[model samples]
Target chain A: MKKIKLKVPATVANLVCGFDILGMAVHDPYDEMEFRLLETPEIIIKHIDAFGLPEEPSGNVAGIVLLKIQEYFNLKNGFEVIIRKHIKPGSGLGSSAASAAGAAFGANVLLGNKLSKEEMIYFAMFGEELASGVRHADNIAPCIYGGITLVKSTHPIDIVSLNSPDLFVTAVHPQVEVKTSDARQILKKNITLKSAVEQWGNIAGLVAGIQKNDFPLIGRSLNDVIIEPIRSILIPKFDEIKAKSLQLGALGGGISGSGPSIFMLSEQKETAEKIAEMMKSVYTEIEIESFVYVSKINPSGIQIVEEV
Target chain B: MKKIKLKVPATVANLVCGFDILGMAVHDPYDEMEFRLLETPEIIIKHIDAFGLPEEPSGNVAGIVLLKIQEYFNLKNGFEVIIRKHIKPGSGLGSSAASAAGAAFGANVLLGNKLSKEEMIYFAMFGEELASGVRHADNIAPCIYGGITLVKSTHPIDIVSLNSPDLFVTAVHPQVEVKTSDARQILKKNITLKSAVEQWGNIAGLVAGIQKNDFPLIGRSLNDVIIEPIRSILIPKFDEIKAKSLQLGALGGGISGSGPSIFMLSEQKETAEKIAEMMKSVYTEIEIESFVYVSKINPSGIQIVEEV
Candidate 1:
């Protein structure tokens, strides 16, 4: 194929009680990219839709993933990749994962899909490594596979998408910057064994609940005992947003990934919309710009929007 | 019903990564009890088996459970309970759970089966409190529910049975005793946050694996990072037996509850028997008395062997 265009959806990672192991794909606010083959073996990238991201291959998230793929495969042909970024950076909405997964997915399409899904994720994680100074697949796996995904192990990188019912999600990203490193640094190196047991029970229940499609079980199991107590301190007005979300019929709500963004799950679209309103109220009180996305769980991770 | 004879199977609690939360019931080595309604308002318990167990109503596990039921229901009538104990105490094979659950279950039957399964487990947990000095329901829940069970919380005692495939079990209980209190005391009060994360991932995977009937996934997820490392030291040749069992095609195995009894899961009955052989070989080398049980996952927790 001479050219290909793909759309990669935004993902929520570090799920409640799942921390660095579980994630899910959301339908709205995706990053779009187009790739065209060039004669010389040089990666050329341009930001078609801008959020002041670096245009160079080394500094850019998508370009770094594409460059890694090129180096691994030793491709003689180069590609000019066009980026249309929609997901905001540092919002804990998997902005870097979208861009990185888009590049790897697009490059694979150009190569006639020779790489396996696992291989694609391996290549895409480099983008996360470059962006966050950490190599993690929690976000990228869901972005590539769609739906709720589990990264059972990171060393060999085993990932599987968990089938789930049609559930609505409400995500709110307040106009604030919360560094991922700062969010991670505040967590305790050691946790009480009592808390660990409680945390494991909730995680197991959550996984089983999603598979069994038991919504009430999911609601009861959506709790984080290990990471949330410390990380919630970094987010502004975290308690107010979470309390209001739960009070307004949202099944459960917590800090999405690191900070500045909060998310809730609901059974109905109307309830999700109402939860979104509750999310916006927090930022509105402070007169800060906020973005709310109300959507269903996206089953298609990265799609080929247009292909040649 | 005037009289009922019930058989309650032995259970394995903690289940490696599940630590005070997960348990499973086995088919063999059950405690047999016969309950007969009496006109007098005094509980009578007779030890029919030759284990020299207490025959007193308040001191015996089954009698204590039956007396509690009598008090809870305000029953003027009493029961003459005959206990034939086959599972030995301090074996990590849930001997007390069997007796306690059998009493509650038999009493519920006499009352025209008015109590739900959850209520039966609740009443039976007091029996565990009397035996182990801790009010844990892990063993009792599985003994009554008849499958792999998860005790999500113990405050109100929330429990659920996870659906599993037809997997065979091979359990070996050495004559040595490991006190429950000692086993519990050796565990670290706090665990590293990294180990806790890894432990939660395995627990979630194990729950999903059992629900999905994925044998390989179940094998991969049957690990205990927190409890086994410390508790296994109390069991003689624990490492050798586990290694031998795995090498002989057993899916996985670990310290059954606390120590002295080790269990292995296999995909076939023949493999389970082979694992049992491996377990017996450990004790055989030392010329110690050991009991080996090869059976499948019991779907019937407590059964009415003879009823009138």
Candidate 2:
């Protein structure tokens, strides 16, 4: 089998009120992939040391995804794969989604494009389900297509591409890990009717804001009462970082996903970099080491870097 | 207060997946009013017929609404009022909202245009809060100013008037009573996460439908998974009415508010009337006496019919 290389961008899910429903892709943070065609009818995966992936392809996140797709198509091609990770894992920046989506995208291209974008999202979600124990496309859809993407529904993965201009995104990954399982476990099974009303109002407003290109409305709508309150407790100085980011001229920012990282959206590139610096300062004051990424909205998801 | 005549249209709240947020007014089944100037300094009320209204002006639904406005603005004028009920009281057709909004509109004219539409709605909602034990403006806003309205936030009554064309509405009121409290009590405290996602998807589609004036999309969006399931059980032959209405070319219909009434929307006025007849026939087959009304969208809400 021959080798192939692919690149997948980092993504952010749960964009404020869009909890479990919306996601977007970032340009700077990415993961690299190497795929090799094999002689036998078996798939094998190897992590290129940087990604810290599991050895067996079937056990590895990206490898299991490829195996499921191959099984679905009953393909007999054997392959060896390697992944090089740049996006930090557990940063709430969709590092796992980048790997899973990148693998699925690369494999589908290698298989002569048998699936549509919607089909790719469906297949990619199987990889997400493997990682999180539940099928979710909020992160995968955006990682696949980039920019503002709405997982309008999960049953069929109705991905609606929103008209979001290329804006700067500032993200801070603190030296902490908040497991998605632990973060999800803390959410109340039944939200109060009061909170549900507020959440839906914000969700509607956020959708309108994005469509109308109203930044302040977007900032105001980027508020979550149900999940963030419970999840923010897992990340230290979450409130301080958010406050400093806003103080530094960010429209608004919050926990990226189930996170120890925080991200902010800014209309200008300078504001995004400034917000990133402010976030770093706040984390330093709290005695926590952090990595900052200043990027733009990625309109394309996974792409071929070079031919095999 | 000089004698004045006003009419307020009936409103439908919780339009399908909107739950507590969306409402609209129809031209038929409205409440009539005759306001009179009083010599006495105290408010007085009289019921011309068996409308089951309070005799005391301050205690009557309409009178209470006016009194609140008077108190808020420190007005000393007294008024005599009489209301003619046309919309049935317990058919979930916003009967209370009609009376409250009608009184507020009438009094605003009597006081020489002292309040804005926003203020009038705020006063009218106070009357509704007395009846429902909660403040909601979905019905009241439409009763004041018609067309498709979204009660984006209820605390301050942020009303967003959506761009919608004149829609034909067919409504059927089954001769029965379903207490709002009983209907509300039947809903599940916790819904599956899956249902919530579907609910929001429908809402997004519904909003787009209203904005785009797409009748088919509107009909498709008129699906309720949260409130209607529980509330419709209290409406006899509810399923048959919905089925027949759809079969008769009505776009879609569901239980209006907390119900003994069901309503459907159609693109043509003739079809609306046809749907209404179909509903009436279905109720007759079930041996349940019912009343049907076919009307178009009410663009302007409560208005002065005659001035002294």
Candidate 3:
């Protein structure tokens, strides 16, 4: 292909008790990318939306992934990638993952789909490592594979995309940033064995709920006894947003990733819409510009927007 | 009915990463109980097996469960319960849960099946409390509900029986005692958050594996980063047994509940039997009398042998 355009979905990671293990994709507020083959042996990147993201091939998230793919595949051809950023950066909505995954996915299409999805994730993780100094794929896996994904092991990078339930998601980003590093530092290195047992039970229940499509069970299992208690402090009015959303018939939700954004799930579209409205109230009260999305889980993580 | 006879299967608790939450029942080894209605306002208990277990209604595990049921149902009529213990005590095979579950199950049949399985578990937990000084129901839930049970919550006692796969189980009781209290005392009160994350991932994967009936997934997901690391030390030749079981085509296995007994799961009956033979070799080399059982998961937790 001479040129390819890709739409990459936003992902919410650290799903309650599934810290660093689970993530889910949402359809709305995605990142779009355009890639074109160039005649010169040079990689170029540009951001259509102004977010002050690094555009240098060595420093940019998407550029880094593209360079990794090119180097790993021994591709001498040059490429130019333009990104249209919609999922806000540092919103804890997997903005970096979208860029990273889009770069690898689009580049793979040009490479005749030589790499597997897992390999693409392996390459994209360099972008995450560039941003966070950690090669974690909880967000990238779901962004690339779509729906719910579990990073079973990171060393061998075993990731499995789980069956998705037909449910609606509501996300609210309150125009604030909770630096991932600060959130990481706040958490205790150790947790009580009691809490860990309870947390694993919820994780198991949550997986069973998703597989069986038991929405109420999913709601009941959305508990994070370990991380939420510490990290929710980073999100403004976190309690109010969660309580209101749940009260409005949202199945359940918590701080998205490490916060500033909160997401909830509902079985019905109307309930999801209502939950979004309720979540927005917290940002409104705080007088912050917030972004709200009510959408179904995107089953296809990255799809071809247009072909050459 | 004037008399009710019940057989409650043996249960394996603390299923790898599902510590204090998951359990499964096996049909081969069980405890049988016969409960007869008497015209007095007292409860009588007798042990047909030579275990020297308490025959009093307050001290015996089965009698305690029967008393609790009678008190809850406000039944003035007395019950004479005869216990035939087959699952050896302190073998880490949930011998107490079998007795407790058998009592509650038998009494419920006499009460015209008024109690739901969950309620039966709630009452049976008292028997566990009487035996262990704790009200945990990891074993009780599976002994009462069969299949694979997850005690997701304990306060309100929310328990779910997951779908059972067509897998074979091999168990070995090495004729040694690993006190549950000792096994528990060795565990640290806290675990590193990193280990907990890995543990919860395995748990989520295990639940998914059982739901999807994916044997390889089940085998892959049977890791215990937290509990087994410490608890396996209590079992003799623990590492060798587990390594050999896996090498012999057993999907996965670990310390049954705490120690002394080990269990392995296999995709076929022949593999399960082979796993049992391999496990027996360890005890035979050490000159220990070990009992081996190769069986499928008991879909029905408790069944009535006869009714009068």
TM-score of each: 0.98, 0.84, 0.98
lDDT of candidate 3 over A28-116, digit per residue (tens) = 88998999987676899999998999899999999998888778767779889989999998898999999998998998898888989
Complex DockQ, candidate 2: 0.27
- Across residues B218-255, which tens digit of lDDT does each residue of candidate 2 receive? 77768877778778888888887788778878888798
DockQ numbers for every candidate?
A: 0.82, 0.27, 0.87
Ranking by DockQ: 3, 1, 2
Name the candidate that leads on DockQ.
3
Residue B276, candidate 1: C-alpha displacement in angstroms: 0.8
Those runs of model 1 whose alpha carbons end farther than 4 Å from true positions after fitting are none
**Candidate number with the higher lDDT (1 or 2):** 1
Q: Candidate 3 docking: what grade? A: high
On residues B1-308, what C-alpha lDDT tens digit does candidate 1 reach at each position? 89999988999887778887899999888999999988788999998777788888888888888888999989999999988889888889999999899999999998899899888987898888889888788889888999898899878777877885699989999999899999989889999989998888888878878888888888888888888989999888999998888999988879888868999999999999988887787799998889999988887788999989
Worst 10 residues of 2 chain A by lDDT: A156-165
What pairs collide in candidate 2? A1-A37, A1-A38, A2-A37
How many clashing residue pairs, candidate 1?
A: 0
Error of 3 at A242 (Å): 1.1
Query: What lDDT score is found at residue A104 in candidate 1?
Result: 87
User: Candidate 1, residues A194-287: lDDT per residue as tens digits?
Assistant: 9998998898888888888888888888999888888888777788888887888888868788867888999989889988887787789888
For lDDT, the strongest prediction is: 3
